[model samples]
Target: MSLIHALQSALGENAVLTQQADRARYEQDWRGLVNNPSLAVILPKTTAQVAEAVKLCAAHGARIVPQGGNTGLVAGAVPILGPDQVILSFSRLRAVRDVDLLSDTITVEAGLTLATVQQEAVKANRFFPVSLAAEGTAEIGGVISTNAGGLQVLSYGNMRAQVLGLEVVLADGTIWHGLSGLRKDNTGYDLKQLFIGSEGTLGLVTAATLRLYPPVATRASALVGIENIEQGLGIFTSIRHAAGNALTLCEFCTQPALSLGAAHTPNGRLPFIAPAYLLLEISALEGARDPREMLETVLMEALEKGRVLDAAIAQSERERLDFLALREAISEGELREGGAVKHDIAVSLSRLPALVRAVEDLVARTYPSLRPNIFGHVGDGNLHVNIRPPAGQTMADIANHKAAITRDVESLAISMQGSFSAEHGIGQLRLLGMAAHKSQTDLALMRAVKQALDPEGRLNPGKTIPES
Candidate 1:
């Protein structure tokens, strides 16, 4: 039987889509930037089925692209064009296998959305802190592949930190089920970690045992107008020290970003006109001192010291969500404008000001026709400094400068001792950036690991690790 027939036999015909129309949505990325059509998309409902599909593909030396929510920004989940690769989508593997409240772990199939997992935890009066704008659609598999870091990374870490155990299907179809809820397994060489940020080059993550925490009993939120991004950083540092782990979030946004949010978001307008703004949040257990009063006191001091220009605190959950809407609406706001050169970069907390300054200098020197939508999780030193041209400037104009602009932006991050791919992984989008910016030694090590795992590059080929 042919590969299609074989896949159809293993997983029903409905699960294996071969026609162009059936594979259309899978081909194009969520951002509409990349569209790499695969020979077929095989949807597996269980780990055993995934293993069988991999075994079938391995026999024919066919490459397989493992995809989850398909909401990735770096195009890693999308298949490489012209490879005749098969897309192994885990959309059907949406099962919560186990939940151990005492161990503070939840074992779930990789296809479960982050929002679903968070809701499950909420039902149990626990919390899962790995969150992002794409939480509604992004699955655990893709999240694990990218090692995604989101707003709560300052308090709880990224996907890499949240994973307690993982079950992965090897390139040769062997299942490595290490789903132990143990907090510490002094075992040699924690193999599960290899697939955490491997972006599916190493293996296909079928499921994961993730860490959970006590649900926050009290919360407070504020949207503060800042004199500048640097002042936003200052405010973040002070709050971090004063509130410690209670400081849940400190998201920074530039004037242009606020303008975009104000213009596009229907309800919330930028309350004050300033160089920058911060959407800050603090949360604590019920027994602890009131988080609202603590946040208010900190903001009062910040205001007195000129670290903050203006502030609007959220006294209710509705008001808190309204404040958060401004931060969450940034991507949509940028999209409403037009094409953009986007970068997610990170640096030391102390040098965030330097990174911002460098970005400003780069824009002044090269992109006079564009506006910078500077925003990100400032608490963790990650910033998404994207450049968007005005309506008058054509996309062709933006395209012409995109390559140079991206290089300049990556160069700035390199000079500041920061990283170019902060939360986003080196999927197809950042492959060139990886080659251009990553050191020879780092590339060699990554290549070696890839070779060791998938020797023929039969899994997610031409991504993550750049060729030598």
Candidate 2:
């Protein structure tokens, strides 16, 4: 029988989607840049099914593109340049297998959305704080694979830290049952960490055991306008000093980002028309003192120190949602306005101001007329540097300039001992950047690991690790 026929026979008709329309949906990514569709879209319902499909593909020398919700910023979920590959999507395997409230951990299938996991935690009177705008759709497998760092990274760290264990299927169809909730394990290599941010190139994540936290009893959010990025950093330091671990998130938004939000999104409210902006949030556990009052006192101190020009604190839950709406709306607003060159990078907390100023100055001198939107989780030092050229410039123009801009910005980030791809994983988008930034020895070690895990190069090849 043919490879397609073998896959269909093993997975049944309902699990295999072979039509052009269905296959088309799996071709491109969120950015709509890469377009390499496949001959079939396999929806595996279990870890055995995933391993079986992968084994069959290996036997036939076929390539497999493992995917989750397809909400990736880079084109990592989509195929690179061939139509002969198979797009193995994990959407059908949505299942929460186990939840140990006493242990403060949950084991869920790869297809479960991050939002669903969060809801499950809430139902159990616990919390899962790794949140993003796409949490409603982005799946747990993709998040773990990408090691996504969201708004709460300042307090909770990234997905890597949140995951205690995982169930991964190797390239040769063997299942590695490392899904233990034990916090302390010095048995051997600690295999779970290898696949957490491997981007599915090393192994296919079937399920994961994630750490949980106590649910927040009270929360406070505010949008504070600062004179510049320096003041924003100062406020962050001051608030962290006052509230300690109670501080949940601290995001920075530039004037351009606020302007874009005000112009595009509905009900977009900019509290203060300052050069830079800061969005601060804090949450406290039950029986703890109200975090709102503490946050207010910190902001008041910032104002006294002349670090904050103006501020708007959320009075109700609805008001807090409105304030967050402005920050989340910036990306869509900027996209609607025109084309933009985007970068997800990180620098040291102490060096953010200098990095931002240097990059801004470099862009101004180089592009002359480009207005960049600089904003992200300032508490964690990750910033999304988006460049929007003046009106009438085609997207091609922006694409043409991506290399030069990326070089300058990435160099600056590297100089400060920061990551080139902070939240966004090193998909095909940053393969070249990886080469530029990473050392020869580092790249070789990564390749050796990839080869050791997926010897056939069938599991999401042409991603994460550069070509050997």
Candidate 3:
């Protein structure tokens, strides 16, 4: 029979969505960048069902797009390959399979939200360190697929570090049940790494086993106003030196970005306004020194040294979240402020200031009418450099210049030996960038891997690796 009929018959009619309205939510990307309808959207509740759906799709010669929470900044989870592809959504597969407190690992189904995973860790008296603004809705599977980086990446590393093992369904419907919590595994190529950030291009992730940490005891957060990025970098160094591994977050934002956030988010008022700002956090475990005392001392030194213009340290949990609210509200503000030509780029810690300076110079010299909204996890050298229309003008005003602007900005990042796409994976949005920034050798090796893992290019077709 037909693929849709087969899927409906095998996985139940409720699991296979064909009507336009039912598939609408799965079709759109988080940023509203893509909204192409797929031939069908399948919500598989079990790994076996996922494999069954994939096998049927492969038999019918239909391409499959594996999706998680669909909260990715890039359009990685949505279908862009016309109306012939099928979207395999893991939304119904959320299950806390195991929580081994002694082993310090939790095995969960792919559909579990990051926030839910964090809650589970807390319930087990442990901690899951990787956190982003979209944690409330972004699934663990997509987080693993993107190798996502967030605030705590400064200390706990990215999603890649947290993952110990994964359960994935291959393109041909073979389930690789390689879920292991072992910390030491040198038994070959470490196959799970291949699927971690593959963007669902190689295999469809069904579940994962992730590392956990000791629960945080003391916590502190602060927002520092600075004269420029250089001053912020100096402050970051001072705090990192003092707090060491305790420093969990170090975010930078331009004055324009702060203004945008304040305009959009609740409790988004700035404590002190300056040319730029830094939001920092520290979490202490066990017998570690009080984080507030440590951060306060570092901030005092920064103010005294003239590296920071002013600082406001959070006194309570509510106050700390308020401080973070302003930082998290940045993307929302950018969207409301007529959108922007966004770039997720990064450089070395030492080269970050140079990158910022060079970006400012580029915008000022070429697109004088455009305003640059720069902010991100500065501690990790990843910054979102977004170019928006000046004040009153909308994104449409700079529509023609978007291509040239993106080219210039990405070129600068490449010149600095940085990345064109940092934490955000290379979805369809960055396919052109993949071609523009990556070397022939790099592309060839990636293509080779794609060939080996997904020979038919059935998984996430025309994504991640660009066409040569």
Best candidate, TM-score: 3
Candidate 2: deviation at residue 256, Å? 1.2
Judged by lDDT against the true structure, how good is candidate 2? 0.88
lDDT scores in order: 0.87, 0.88, 0.92
Regions of model 3 farther than 4 Å from truth:
none
Pairs in clash, predicted candidate 1: none
lDDT of 3 by residue, 316-372 (tens): 999999888888888888877678999999999899989999999999999988888
Off by over 4 Å in 1: none
lDDT of 1 by residue, 138-213 (tens): 9999999999998889898899999989999999999998887888889699888899999999999999999999
Write candidate 2's Cα lDDT for 85-157 as tens digits. Answer: 8889999888998999889999999999999999999999999999988888899999999999888999989
Q: Between candidates 1 and 3, which one is better according to TM-score?
A: 3
Q: Using lDDT as the measure, which candidate wins?
A: 3
Native-to-model Cα distance after best TM-score fit, residue 114 in candidate 1, in Å: 0.2
- How many residue pairs clash in all the candidates, one count each? 0, 0, 0
Q: List clashing residue pairs in candidate 3.
A: none
Against the hidden reference, what TM-scores do the models get? 0.98, 0.97, 0.98
